[model samples]
Target: MPLSEQEQRLLDEMERHLLHNDADVVSAPSGDRTLSYRNLVYGALLLLAGVGALVAGVILGDVWGIVVGVIGFAAMLAGVMFAVTPVRRATPVTPREATSAKRQDSASFMDRMNDRWDRRQDGR
Candidate 1:
């Protein structure tokens, strides 16, 4: 079933309010830290290596095996930690850069939305 006219109007009002109030959120700058592809690759390799060590440990079946198994578990845990940790960006985003980037990316999108809304209102 379709929304009633009143429901549609209310929805439109809510959208307008959200767009107005949440423009900052929509255009928010990514902070100083981000995940590195290099780190992800390295972490994955470490994790695989850890798994191999763990399997070998199981096969050995002795005190040495226990030691290797513990080491492997530690490596796997470290790999996961390393993979998820975000690194600091080399160059910090200046205020000017942030503003310009945000405007360039989001202005056209916001303009398009506003234009569509205007057209919808005019049609009504």
Candidate 2:
């Protein structure tokens, strides 16, 4: 069935209102939050290599070697941090959604049932 002219106008008005007032809701994976297992494995291997290089430098007791060893240790720290750190996933919160959530903070099942009953009574 087709909507009545008045209903169509109301729906169009509502669509316009929503388009103007509602924020764009997009769910996308940020590069930081998307950690692949392959990268993690590679990072772990890099960390191990870095630690070994540092240890070898220390054992050799050379100034240049020590510098290289420190560099390796820093690399190792970077790799380890990369491997251990988890991706932070966050959802973009819109003002309307925040307000609506706050408004319905404690709305329970019974509250919804009562609201439905009231609507039915009003409709009748």
Model 1, 2-121: lDDT tens per residue? Answer: 999977865765565554558676434358877889999999888998998899899888999999998998889888888878888898755564455444545555676689899999
The models' CA-based lDDT, in order, is 0.76, 0.67
Best by TM-score: 1
* Model 1 collision count: 0
The lDDT, on a scale of 0 to 1, for candidate 2 is: 0.67
Off by over 4 Å in 1: 1-30, 93-124
The reply for model 2, stretches above 4 Å from the true place, is 1-34, 85-124
TM-score (C-alpha, index-matched) for candidate 1 = 0.53
Error of 1 at 5 (Å): 40
